[model samples]
Target: MTARHAGYIVTLAEDIREDDADHIMTALRMVSGVISVQPVTANLDMAIARQQVHGEVRGKVLQLLKELQ
Candidate 1:
């Protein structure tokens, strides 16, 4: 049977430096079977960020369609 695990929150031995977090997350995402990695923090609103990105992409596609018409 496949594991029903959703995800995990990895904590570093010491607080990750702002400059190093990107490198660390990138390395974790390179591991086999890893889907995605994001930094967890109180101030970061991932949902809103994802929605904004989706909206931007959608707008761009609509603009391209209009240009093609």
Candidate 2:
């Protein structure tokens, strides 16, 4: 018998600089138990960088919650 757990996906509203993202990831990883922050695609038209922040945090989305709050 085995058990599997579902993960979370967080999307940041603002286009975050790579350095800032790295800092946030470090802070959250300590408690949030994150798996990884995936590719960030910059949209020239919208001037927004979309990134995939995946993990198993029980509460709010890490990237967006951190940046928004």
Candidate 3:
């Protein structure tokens, strides 16, 4: 016999406004099998920082490639 445990973390494609976060969390709590719902704004900030760093790195690589050509 085996027991299974699983969890999921979801990220939205677009940023949710502060005013709407509570509403969103409330809706998620209403869903079945939802043990808990907590908002983590830090992850969103980290994601944005990561994207900015990625863009900077991409631009630098492209510039380097042009210089090498």
lDDT, candidates in the order shown:
0.79, 0.60, 0.83
Per-residue CA lDDT of model 2 for 1-69, tens digit only, reads 897766666667667877667777776577565666574555764442222222334244676688897
**Candidate 1 lDDT over residue span 1-69, tens digit each:** 888977877866545567768878889999888998877663448557767989999999999999999
Q: On residues 1-69, what C-alpha lDDT tens digit does candidate 3 reach at each position?
A: 897657668777667887878888888888888989877675777888879989999999999999999
TM per candidate comes to 0.46, 0.41, 0.53
Number of the top candidate by lDDT?
A: 3
Evaluated at residue 9, the lDDT of candidate 2 is 62
Q: What residue runs in model 2 are displaced by over 4 Å at the alpha carbon?
A: 1-5, 44-69
Cα lDDT for residue 69, candidate 3: 100
How close to the true structure is residue 57 of candidate 3, measured as C-alpha lDDT?
A: 100
In model 3, which regions exceed 4 Å deviation? Answer: 1-3, 43-49, 52-69
